[model samples]
Target: MTLRKPPIPRLLLNNVSCMRNAQQILRHVNVSVHDGGALVLKGTNGSGKTTFLRMLAGFTRPSAGEILWNGHNITESGVFHQYKLHLNWLSLKDAIKEKFTVLDNVQWFEILEGKQGKSMAAIELMGLGRLAKEKARMLSMGQRKRLQLARLLAIDRPIWLLDEPSVALDDEGVKLLEYIIKEHRKKGGIVIVATHLPIEMEDPMVVRLPPRFPRRMTLVDMLDRSGLD
Candidate 1:
């Protein structure tokens, strides 16, 4: 049986703004991405890079704008659940379950995502084949990062939202990451990465978040967090 590919995906951010502690961290940000596209988000700490990625993931709502996926408003309650089905989110934390073995962790993710026969291949691709049975707690920081990438590959999602994905990686590991990302884009995957380190990918678009921000916390910020806003 032949498998059918889904329609090409697109993500759009229009007139987006974000505030925390009552100060604006991002102002009127606008960007768009289509299938096979890569976007590298650059900004200093507190520059709202995390916020922007979270907004795209439907975890954080924009202060004033729309985040659209395939021309549908992703921020809407009815659409968020469906929107995330296509996403693979890698946040600051590696999301590794320390009690599980390397293989177990990867396999668990594949199970959750309803994929099969892919975990071992992804483990080898991330250079963790030799350590596949080792407990997660025993892996070095770099190896743990690689394991996260392996999980990423195993699930085979089309949209990737990575935050500081290259951190703690050595030179060789970085190269492997670049290779994975480059190939993912070739297959029409959409990636948006937030990082302080440089990532070399295939013709990726660079988005520099606004640096100016109010350092003071505001009532709106407190309200948002407390679910009162």
Candidate 2:
């Protein structure tokens, strides 16, 4: 019998580098997210986790290296929209239109994604059925977080890039995030998350980023040097 090789990763970053205000934010980072696996990014605040996510989302271009998907380099691919279609990103702010009701916000997102009927489904999944009609600005912090998560359920994607998903959440909200992540993994989806604390996960590969750097180096190079490769 032929030994099977793992399929190509769904996402890849090779030797990526970035800088802001003359300060290097990231250096020569290389990461791969295979289908059905999770990569946890551990770092302190301002450690470039969000910036890295933005680069992956095509919001910013890397100063060096390439961002690839299944061996196709999206750098200069000039089709960021296509890449965004497959990526589901939840940011720290959990931005919700203050003027729109909870139901309206979810509904608008569904319409935007062209996923009709998902608004109600998402609201129910997030256990927000009771508060769907409440204004977004009126909802408590936990409620807002739930609403943000509802959007994730509504827009199912292969890749989930979550930034500090548990911020300002009660125990219930944390459990909801945990449940969603486990379910997504069970469905063979990929997850990359940046968090300050260790999350309860079943044997996920962990990568911790230092808050300060002695010299400029790529993440891949650092990993290789640290025997983490």
Candidate 3:
């Protein structure tokens, strides 16, 4: 008898495109990432980085093309929820409850994800151990961001989709973020980050979205179309 290696997990974007109000934000984007890999999205403002991440999270439908997970079409299979379980997404918003304590917030996420126990280990990993009992509202913007990133450690997911992760982070905080990402990749995990700041990684795959011409839309209209209004 012979032993065989298990198949590696993968995420594929095939000619993916996104449109808002009849205007194209992203056009014919293609990418492929396997286990233990990293993909970086670099672009100027309004270049569809956020839109690409949102599409991967299934928050919005793409106007054209397909997104595949391990070679299966996620949208076509109607398994979005199941697909989500295998990945974690950190958007621009921290999504933290101000009333909850640092530790409580992490615990809440664990419970919501059907996971048990607290995430003290993750809390410490993010350098929030001393503030574990402090209310989320008391923490600084950078601390709150660290707390959000800590949730990734609590949940064992194979894929990570991050948007502007380094925003508001200090030099030390940025270093910590880099360490976490590298460690995650070493453990056979996949990471995709969209950021304006630089992130140090070993030969990461890069995708650059071309800048789009600004459309004549009000601030309110843009917010509404982005589902943020």
lDDT of each residue in 1-229, candidate 2, tens digit only: 9999988887788998887656688788888877888888788887777877777878888889988887777665555657778889899777699989998887887788877777787898788999888888889888888898898888788889888888877887788788888989999988888888656766677766667554568898889999984
Tens digits of per-residue lDDT for model 3 on 1-229?
Answer: 9989866448888998889667787789888888899999899977888987888888878899988887887896467767888989998888899999999999888888898654898899889999999999999999999998888788768899999999988999899999999999999899999987899998799988888877678999989989993
Q: Is candidate 2 or candidate 3 better by TM-score?
A: 3
Worst 10 residues of 2 by lDDT: 74-83
Give the per-residue Cα lDDT of candidate 3 at 127. 92
Q: In candidate 1, how many Å is residue 159 off?
A: 0.6
Instruction: Estimate candidate 2's alpha-carbon lDDT, on a 0 to 1 scale.
Output: 0.82
Clashes per prediction? Answer: 3, 1, 0
Please report how far candidate 3 places residue 123 from its true position, in Å. 0.9
- For residues 1-229, write the lDDT of model 1, one tens digit per residue: 9999866349888888877657686778788888999999999877878887887888877888888888889977778888889999987788899999999999998999877899999999999999999899999999999999999999999999999999999999999999999999999899899998988887788888777645578899899989993
Better of 1 and 2 by TM-score: 1
TM-score computed on alpha carbons, candidate 3: 0.87
TM-score per candidate:
0.87, 0.85, 0.87
- Per-model RMSD to reference: 8.4, 8.6, 6.6
